[model samples]
Target: MPQTLKTLGPKAAADLDGDLMSDAGGFSIDQLMELAGLSVSQAVYNVHPPSAGNNGGDGLVAARHLYFYGYTPVVYYPKPTKKPIYDGLVKQLNNLHIRFDNETPFDKLAGESDLIVDALFGFSFQPPVREPFDQAIAVMEKGVKPVLAVDTPSSWHVEDGPQNEGLGSKYMPDYLISLTAAKPNVGHFKGKKHFIGGRFLGEDVAKKYNLNIPEYKGLDQIVEVPVDVKVEKL
Candidate 1:
């Protein structure tokens, strides 16, 4: 039997996004990036076991350096400018004084860090990545360490899943922070990819159509325009 992709229910989507966006003192991109950093950091722990001693932590053996890959210049290219995660993301890294680099050669990024945060692509990418980005993606696929894709990794025909009418599958993320309410059936047609089952969205927004980082209340609010709902006059 073919492996199946799980559906994200409304409550589940809200729960995921809410957990990230909701803060007592309103929302900010810095907060979101901080949450994301922590999330990726934890994911690091999940993949690599804690060190034998030194209080059972990874014990600094795993490199602290984290690299971000993406087209920062045009985070919202072809789309209207809006609040983006890129700014807060880099700022958060700087605040933490984390050794982070951006838009480097994919191989260099792959080799330099123990973990890679794949922010190279977002939901905005409708057409396939051509040329340099494609080459870069190919390199990313070769890294030995675990990859934490911000949105989803770039892949072929991922958007053209069997269930385009059902749920659309962009690129698959090893782990996904859905940003806002998880789109129902959004990733149902992931071909042969294996995604760990925990995707979250921002709770503040009702939907998450654009990548703009809006004030949220957890991952439990509407963040974007809901894609065309399958009409069912019941």
Candidate 2:
């Protein structure tokens, strides 16, 4: 239950019910965001491990352009309730020394980016994205640089399984980092085979990655790729 609901008594909760407790099944949006962010982080570490002396056997970590497209901006959110959420995430990205942009111009973003991280639409998204997200899609489409989508690529339908639609906004990331669990949508994803991984970091890896939260730490590590996971593809 949401913190707001938990505070209310049964009758009070019932009075304001429906939307407050809409039947979206189990997971909350906040949990999903955390899952998505941490999953991407793990994937980044796997694909681009730090140098031997740095973290894991990770090589020298390079700063790359990471794009965060969803409703929330990395460093800030217009809504007061959402500020801390985005801020915490932005701090993490900054701690990792990543360069990121949110809803910037397509041409300018394309020219500047080496790697793009798609943190936009997820399993919760229904259909065509509205104004800002659509605009974000346009910019992403302007370039063919490598991408690592946070959950599923924007506009990719989770309900339909992971099949490539090949539409203008039907993005297929080079890597589709699933959050807590793998979703069927990825198999149908269009890019090179999606590499399935999660934030289920082992305790030692968590310590290595500087993740200390009790609930957030100790997730099962999924990949065995070298610490320095980046490479030039053929």
Estimate candidate 1's alpha-carbon lDDT, on a 0 to 1 scale. Answer: 0.37
- lDDT per residue, candidate 1, 140-173, as tens digits? 4554445544433444232332223212222333
**Per-candidate local distance difference test:** 0.37, 0.42
- Counted clashes in each candidate structure: 35, 16
Reference-based lDDT, residue 95, model 2: 72
Give per-residue CA lDDT, model 2, range 9-113, as digits (tens).
Answer: 223222222222345224444554454444555565554443311211000111212223111112211122356665565566567644345444544554554
Poorly placed runs, candidate 2 (over 4 Å)? 1-36, 48-83, 90-103, 161-170, 199-220, 224-234
Give each prediction's root-mean-square deviation over alpha carbons.
11.1, 13.2
- Tell me the lDDT of model 1 at 215: 39
